[model samples]
Target chain A: MVKLTLNVVMAERNITSRELAAAIDITPANLSILKTGKAKAIRFSTLAKICKVLDCQPGDILKYIDD
Target chain B: MSKWLKFGINCVIVLGRISIVFAYLLIILPLGNFYPVIKGTLPKTILHNDNFLLLPGKHTVTAAAMQSFPSWPYAILILIGSIILIWAIIKHLKALIIILTNLRDADYFAVTTVGALKQLFIARIAMIIGDLFLASGNQLTRSWFYLVNNDGVMGATWSSAVADVWMAIFFGVIYVAYRYTLTLKAENDLTI
Candidate 1:
């Protein structure tokens, strides 16, 4: 399974979900979807923006886990 | 869409609804076989066998001919087929009205439109099968214009069967196109 670790990264950077969502120009609802791994997909552009705003690699936010 | 086009669609929807009410007459009028009130109201020109099965010298053989006419299962077949055909046409027309209404609202690309397309496809299939029964029953009914007008008003031959098949194929194609469109829409929606 592919799980997102965005909350962990956000917490490590001492940034709130609202701040990241505002910086990435996404609604907090959408950020919550991503954080909870409920989104069907993530766009490349959105991923690039999130990476830029959080100063993290894609790997740090997206991790592969087996269930 | 153009305003005129929208107006035209609305007009067609209204007309389509009106015609559905009249389409019931197709079944109701035929029931005159049993009901005297309906049979009495119809003009001789419509109910007379001579008008339906006219020969060159057969003008005088009119009145009691209906009593002698051997219309066994054929009449019943035609009635049943017409009922189903009318039902199918009503379904098709309703789906069309919904699609048009959605278009007027600039909401044509919706799951509702896809559902309407599916209903259109199903209605067409039902119509094709129903028409086969109608044409076959009409063929058996034989309007005796056999030599004069091979395919008269009530007597449609297999040629119409061919046209009906083509229509069903066209509906199938449209339904498949909309199915693909729905897939694309779903994928697009997921790509946030």
Candidate 2:
């Protein structure tokens, strides 16, 4: 399963979901969905934007877990 | 657009509640007076002329009229049809109130709203079917009583009901389209 490490990154950067959503130009609800690994897929453009805002690589925010 | 939708839903909710109250007061209330007719205790001639009459006032029927009076089958059918129509109205009103309440919360793309719309559609169809039963029952009553001499003159006109049925069908189609729109909105909301 592909899991998102957005919460860990946001926590390390000392950013709240609302602040990150505002900075990334996405809704807090959608950010919550992504943080909770409920999102089915993420756009590459959105990934690039999140990586730019958080000063991290795509590999830093995403991980693959073998079940 | 949501503002307009809220306003329209509020209007429908108010109108639906008022219609439910009026239906009970005007139609259901007078039905109690016809209990004797419904029970077949009184001579069915009392309802011969007014097949679809909700309330029949005090009238003295002659013995000769009683002898020639038609049976109670048509009157019973009309009574059942009236009950069904009232039931449909109440069901429609309940569905409208739920939909309006959900709309107030800006939950346009909800499954509950779609279910309510489906209920409203079914209620309208039931009302149309009730109207059909009323019309046919009235016609049968008139023919059985051989009261055709006053043709094109007195009695209830069913043309408006026919138009209403057509209007209901049109709105049913619109509701289907709205449901599709809601489905699309749901998909879009989840896409992010």
Candidate 3:
């Protein structure tokens, strides 16, 4: 299963959801869905934009665990 | 899909309601008048006036011709089949109107569309079975359905059901396609 660690990475970087959503040009609702791992899939361009805003790699945001 | 398409659909919905009433009257009036005269409850004098005969246009049936019918078993089948047939038609029109309303509102992928498609698919199948029974019943009661000049098709054979089978298949395909569309929309909505 692919689980997002976006909340942990944002907390570690001292960034609020609103600031990150505005910086990444995404709606707060969608950012919430992503942070809560409710999203079905993430676009590569959107991931690149998020990585750029957060100054982090995709691996820093995404984690896989066996069920 | 067009600017005035919704207007056209609304017109059809109105017309379909009227057609439903006519459908009932057409069948019911003929059966009502036919059975009473056959059983001798209604006087033959009642059918003496041409205007009093309630059969559809270009058709006339004598009480004697009606008396020649096999019996009430097939007549009962006809009544039951007609009821089921009309019910299926009503359901189809209702489902179509609802789905069209959803499209007009720009809610094409709404759950109501799936429900309407499923209803349509089931209704089509019901219509086919209803038509089969009606056709067979009519075939057995052929003497009564004669034309005014005694020159017309007596009754439909089971071969006529082929067209209904095709229609049911068409609706089944449409129902499956709509379900796939809804599934794709669900996946797309959750993607970010």
Candidate 4:
């Protein structure tokens, strides 16, 4: 299973979901979906935007968990 | 922003209401005139042959007569069917009004429009079933009195408005497709 570490990264950066969502020009609900690992898949463009906003690499925000 | 379309929808809504009232009046007025006759003939039973099997070249005809049955039960079934049809029509009209209103407001992709279309489809199915029931009731009543004509041919045939049923089913399929598209659009809209 693939898990999102967006919440951890956001926490380390001292950024709220609302602020991150606004910075990325995305809805807070969608950010919540990604943070909760409920997203089916993430677009590379969206990943790039999130990584740029949070000043992190894709690997820092995404993790592959063994089921 | 077509004025003609708005005018058309408004006219349909008004016409729908008028037709509903007219149908109710038709039912009520007839009941009023037939109440006394029906009361006087209350609980009346009738008996008649249901089938006549003609043996091949045997010069023998076997006729089976159904037992005496009260006419009121069939009458009540017809009345119930009529009421169901009326209710279905009203539901369809309401769904149409909602769809038109949503279209006018440029909310064509709203979930309420999908819900209304589903309701209209179900109501059409209900109306078709109701019509079938009414037709069966009519056939049953006719069979109670006469099943064969003077030409020795079956006279009381079970029949329904095939065109109406097919039309309803056709529109139901279209609505189902439209609803599916709306569902897809709604999901896409939420997929930020």
Question: Which candidate's DockQ is highest?
Answer: 3
Candidate 1 local lDDT, B42-141, one digit each (tens) = 2232344443454465455344554444454555665666677777777887888888888878885888888888898888777777767667765543
Per-model TM-score, in order, reads 0.77, 0.63, 0.78, 0.65
lDDT of 3 at B132: 80
Give the lDDT of residue B16 in candidate 4. Answer: 72
RMSD of model 4, in Å? 8.0
Chain B only: TM-score of model 2: 0.64
Query: What's the distance in Å from true for residue B64, model 4?
Result: 18
Ranking by TM-score: 3, 1, 4, 2
Better of 1 and 4 by DockQ: 1
lDDT of 3 by residue, B4-81 (tens): 897887788788778777766655633663475467543342334343324466366666765565555565665666
Clashing pairs in 3: none
Residues B109-165, candidate 4: write the lDDT tens digits: 777887887888788777767766666655664455442221111121233446557
Q: What does the lDDT come to for candidate 3?
A: 0.73
**For residue B93, what is the lDDT in candidate 4?**
75
When summed lDDT is taken over every stretch of 10 residues in candidate 4 chain A, the lowest stretch is A34-43
Q: Tell me the tens digit of each residue's lDDT in model 2 across A1-67.
A: 9899998999899989998899889999899888887787788888988999999999999999998
Cα lDDT tens digits for candidate 1, A1-67: 8788999999999999899999999898888888888777899899999899989899999999999
Off by over 4 Å in 4: A1-3, A14-41, A63-67, B23-74, B140-168
DockQ of 1: 0.54
Clashing pairs in 1: none
CAPRI class of candidate 3: high
In candidate 3, which residue ranges exceed 4 Å CA deviation?
Answer: B1-3, B17-34, B37-68, B143-156
